[model samples]
Target: MRRVIGLVLLLLSVSLSAQALSWAYAFVVLDGRVYEVMDVAVLDDDLGEVVGEVKTMADDMDGSYYGDASNMYPIGTTYRKVNGEAIEDVLAVEDESGWKRAEYRHDAPFSMRDHLDKVAYGFVGLGLVVFVMYRFRRTR
Candidate 1:
């Protein structure tokens, strides 16, 4: 029974630790620029060609809390993108002619900066409600 308990604890700890180290974001490089992307899909249609290869893989430590380019394409691996759409927000690449090589949905990472105003307003509203309740109780 003691051995079983120890095994359970060990497994629990391992699982907890693994959950803490999750990949938060992924990125790709094309034409000397880096793009934050999500929902990457590689289709089986031949409509794209090789554009560039991944020259470097971002390190996990490079970005805080998995925000870095760590979860990136493997180094030295070639990638393809749809022509005339490279500069746009979304990027789609192709490996050859029959299938879509890769498609990257670009979007900014979730940051407190983007929603600071909303958060501040929420806090202010909560405080106002609390203040009104306090005033009502005091009057009573």
Candidate 2:
């Protein structure tokens, strides 16, 4: 029974440590100001064929979650349209330049931050109590 309890606690600690990396829309800061990522047009490169129509209209993007144009993807410094506000797949764009592919990672919703905060703090408090109990019991 003691071994089983220890295993469970170890597993829980490992799971918390290995939590998945959440996505966030990180803006590439330049020139001391946040410049909008303009359309990453595809040249005659093979990357162009991979990115579809999304690259052509990046300039017209209203925001990360809106507009007919595509949002900037972190996967590649290019434009990719996610159906609805949720990012889905990558797309290509075309213009006088050529073609290029794009993918975007947007900031995670606020709920994720709250949930992570709770989990992290909870674990810390639990660990502190467990350590104190173990030390006291050992001395006794």
Candidate 3:
């Protein structure tokens, strides 16, 4: 019974972890400002040329949520569209660039921080506690 409970708990924990990662947002630093990314694009070099676009415009009511360009990715100075008040923040530009391909996001989760280190520390602390308890009970 104890083994079955532990296995079930482990499965539940792993599923919850996956859910958290799935909802993780990708951030983009634009002009020294960081924005939550709901989408990504791949653009051409210098002058911020559009190498792709969204064939069908997204229905964004609260604010704009679409663009007509693309970019390699964020970091080290890259050109990408963001949902904000900018003259260039339009669903479809006059020049028109189609979505080269579905812009998928592939970012390192918790990579920018010491989350892994903290988790490791937690495991080590837990192991030490369990060991101490076991040793005390055995001696008693």
Maximum-TM-score candidate: 1
lDDT tens per residue, model 1, 9-115:
99999877643334455566554345555454545352256656555455464343112122455565555555555544444432233323233444434545336
> Comparing 1 and 2 by TM-score, which wins?
1
Q: Could you say which candidate leads in lDDT?
A: 1
In candidate 2, which residue ranges exceed 4 Å CA deviation?
Answer: 1-110
Kindly give the number of clashing pairs for every candidate.
Answer: 10, 14, 7
lDDT of 3 by residue, 23-42 (tens): 23433322212233344333
The lDDT for every candidate, in the order shown, is 0.52, 0.41, 0.37
How many collisions between residues are there in candidate 3? 7
- Candidate 3: residue pairs that collide: 41-71, 42-70, 42-71, 43-70, 43-71, 53-98, 53-99
Alpha-carbon TM-score of each model against the true structure = 0.38, 0.24, 0.22
* Model 2 lDDT per residue over 1-140, tens place: 99999999999998877543332332322111122333665344334222222211222222322122323433234433323322233344333455433343343223343356579999999999999999999999
- lDDT, candidate 2, equals 0.41
Candidate 1, run of 10 with poorest lDDT: 61-70
Candidate 1 ranges beyond 4 A from true positions: 1-23, 40-42, 64-70, 93-140
Better of 2 and 3 by lDDT: 2
